[model samples]
Target: MPPAANRPRAVAIELNAVLVALIGDEPQVLTLENGALLPSGPFEGDHPTLQTGLRAWVERQTHHPLGYVEQLYTFADRSRAAATLGRRIVSISYLGLTRERAAAGEHEPGWQSWYRYFPWEDWRGGTPAVLSRQLLPRLRRWIDAAANAMTKRERRQRVEVNFADATWNEDLVLQRYELLYEAGLVPEAAARRPIADPLPGAPMHYDHRRILATGIARLRAKIKYRPVVFELMPPDFTLGQLQLAVEALAGRPLHKQNFRRLIDQQGLVEETGAVSAETGGRPARLYRFRREIVIERAVAGSKLPLSRSS
Candidate 1:
């Protein structure tokens, strides 16, 4: 084949948005004042690297210097261009972790629960009844209505992927949204016309809903293998608080006994002999994350032997 015909084309990268705010234990995600999302425009000029560009874009928009950041994923649906005034836009998404700072120079910003955008993701209390009561029914109907066998198979695959009950895999957050988008059940896709109303969970403008999923999925998966949870927590907290934070991230209740055992065995915390007056039921001792764990034993990575049997 001729070089021109065989050449791989480069995607015309455009500026996209970065969604941020402090949700749970740490400064989590921030919402845009417009009730849209907290995303930054893409690079209008050259930058040293993608991380640098993302950081600069966020600082410019929110005046919050991001601390820990990693690429989330890229969203470039063909439909994004259908209603636009120009070319197909591809948003290179990123997740940045930072504590909320004073608006650097008087740029008022909005702060909202990251979960407000995806209520279903908050499993702290338990697997949201809506998942089984509402979403699953609709999803199953969508799965059954698949016109052909291949489409049906695809739907099943996605369901198994996101709602892995045999074992709740925390990493499929974004994949779930993408699958829903593909099925046209989500608002952003063209096929979404049939389901005009939002599902039980909260919604965001345009592709922002899916973006929120991306963040949730990333954070959930990260907690298992990283101490990123501390980034959202106070320097000192009780084991109960830690469990609550993890549960919040996981969007489900955990076995409290098992959770405490896991934390104590892991040596992830150091007792301060300080009672948290903020806790009501009983005075709880406060502790701080062993600062060295991030370097020692590689944070030992968080893990809870969670079971649905409550």
Candidate 2:
């Protein structure tokens, strides 16, 4: 065995929160350091469970209480800097759903629209202009500049599937971000090569942006099969509000009729015997999510894909 000094040091654990909320027709993520980092802190022993440690960290860092929290993937390999410093950092991330409120922290924390960090991922109208005007052309150069024909073919295949002109799968948010990272098309990967024109989006500190992408991909996928989206909604909301929230997360303009039909068929929500004039010019019916339905089992997917007309 190696001497004590030569042995590997204890791993340092970090807890991070990808707190999500809907604001002004967009899905927003709670961030710190002027929207450049997710709320995170060291996992201290004052907490009993891993989750307790995470909650304390988030509340302390962002001053936002977590609701409907779930464990996100651990990023143990995020230790490039730490490794150089003779330490290992294993980040245990969590996804927390909460309503937006005024942030209270010394860290200049605020809720940033998820799309601002991933402009190409939004397809509410159609394919983002950055995809064609900026990303694909830049990616083409990266492909052509590859060392050999084999690498070029592989790059072409990934770009076609992820940023395709045909149909786009919204759940590929993390995959797309990772592809951009690999192609050095993202600011985070600028160290790999001098990105002439960095892809349109705000870059987060360290690997926090990648962690955010993972959290978003999970939420986007979870909402499709479950009522997880309701966690981010108010107790009473109009069907229109619900649909808008879903679109904001899915990043696609869902067919309204189809979305409402699926929600009804799945028995996900019901009338609260109240109407909201929140939508201008007309009163819309207010509905609350069927809380008990979650206990019984969420029956159907929200049927998120946009049809041709949408």
Candidate 3:
């Protein structure tokens, strides 16, 4: 350990949350200042643990209780002001799942679709137009700008695997964002010059967008094996509604027959015997997530298993 005078300066723990809710057909995150910042506050001594602190802040600010909350990542923000003040600021981030409350309009400023900040990740309809017409062309330029042949080869490989690969992996959210940030393609990057056009996505305050991506990536992966998707769903829903919720988070379309087949095989949902006609044409049967399945069975990714069958 260093001497008293040489010891590290003050450390302040900041709690940040990416409160997610499925709004309409999109996965929206609660934000402040008209959708510019994630909900965050200083960690107080009253809280016992990090997660407890995060839950408190989110619940107080949003006025909506968090259903499924998990720690995502801890980020260190070393701004000039903090350094000058002899302080180190660390943000402990969490991902909270909840349904959009009707009363959000009163307290929360905005609940914008997370895709607004990462448009390239969505492939539910098909490949996002921005990825083909914008991201790819710019990524090619960045690949070509590499200092050496070896570096160019490495960058090209990353692009191929993360972006241009024939099989698009929905969980590469953070990796995709980092590729753009490293190339100064995102506004959050501390580049010497401004990015022209900048890959066409909304930017957030500080490194909040990166934290949001971390949360999204975690969710996209978790829903594959865990029943966390139900946290974003209603008490009872149609097979179509459940599929839409999964697609909203995964950003990929799943085959109706194959997806429902997996749910049946996994015994994830039980029919509530109620039908909803909102789907149009036919009255769809509603099902509720079997809360007991969490302990009764170990779902091997079959609950949300997407074969993408034709």
Candidate 4:
């Protein structure tokens, strides 16, 4: 180990925001750098707190206000330090949920579908072709390249669980991303290696993609035990619209009948005595989320019924 004085010192704190929204039937995230980066800035003493700083940066960069903000995770790996200065960089990430809005200014950051960054994670129609055709083979080679039997076996087990063919787990977003990173199949990993071809997906600057993965995994798990999905919903929406939003975030198709049953049982919404003519079907009743349920109950789980094929 190097002497204490010779060690790299913490030089900056960065606040990154993973702002998510459901637009049409796609789950979108606000991105900068032509959809290759999250909105982030250096934390300065002028802000009263970390969250305030994050809010200020996001608003200034994207020209949109944030809602339902929560701290995601902090990253301080040595490799995440400034490459040229050899100074440590601590990144504090946050997850923010909001309705989609047009960019306020000409140069504001725009929204891009999150699936563009994790193509294999989307299963709305069926299993994404990228999984078996691209990812699995590459992962198998990675597993076999392990030096020892024990290491190979452990890698295989992780791959099996995280990328299982028969069952898809929505909450494994971070695990899948990390596996790809470890296998050098992502651009971030390739940046550290001599590899040429990397898996398809828009890459972010620094570890912003990893932080987005963490936010995605957290949201997927959170919707199961809390009604936070309402934050992305409009004041009045048809059941079909609600299901589409859930499916978009979960990255899978949901059984319509079962989904409505779950929502009805939870009493999360009430009929608004209005109908939406734009549903592209027979007029569907509009419903508003019952905000009181959030206060009345300790836990209001949004039990999404996933299609087995997903």
Each prediction's TM-score versus the true structure = 0.80, 0.94, 0.92, 0.94
Can you list the residue pairs that collide in candidate 2? none
Which lDDT tens digits does candidate 2 get at residues 65-152?
7888999899988444565576788988999998756546555478899999999888888778998898889889988999999998
Please rank every candidate by TM-score, starting with the best: 4, 2, 3, 1
Candidates ranked, most accurate by lDDT first: 4, 2, 3, 1
Q: How does candidate 3 score on lDDT?
A: 0.84
* Candidate 2 vs 4: which has more lDDT: 4
RMSD of each: 4.2, 2.0, 2.6, 2.2
> What is the C-alpha local distance difference test score of each model?
0.68, 0.86, 0.84, 0.88
Q: Which is the winner by TM-score between candidate 1 and candidate 3? A: 3
Roughly what TM-score does model 1 have, to 2 decimal places? 0.80
Tell how far residue 123 is off in model 1, in angstroms.
3.0
Task: Name the runs in model 2 displaced over 4 angstroms.
Answer: 1-6, 103-108
Choose the strongest candidate by TM-score: 4
lDDT of 3 by residue, 1-310 (tens): 8886798789988899998999897899988888888999999998999888887887788776777788899888576234557788788899998875637465555889999999998887777899999889989999999999999999999899899748778889999898888888888775446766777889987788899999999999988878888888989899898988898898887888888888888888999988998998799999998998687555786545554432
User: How far in Å is the alpha carbon of 19 misplaced in model 4?
Assistant: 0.2
Q: Model 1 over residues 53-108: C-alpha lDDT tens digits?
A: 87777777766677777788887876654235445567787876664554533456
**Best candidate per lDDT, number?**
4
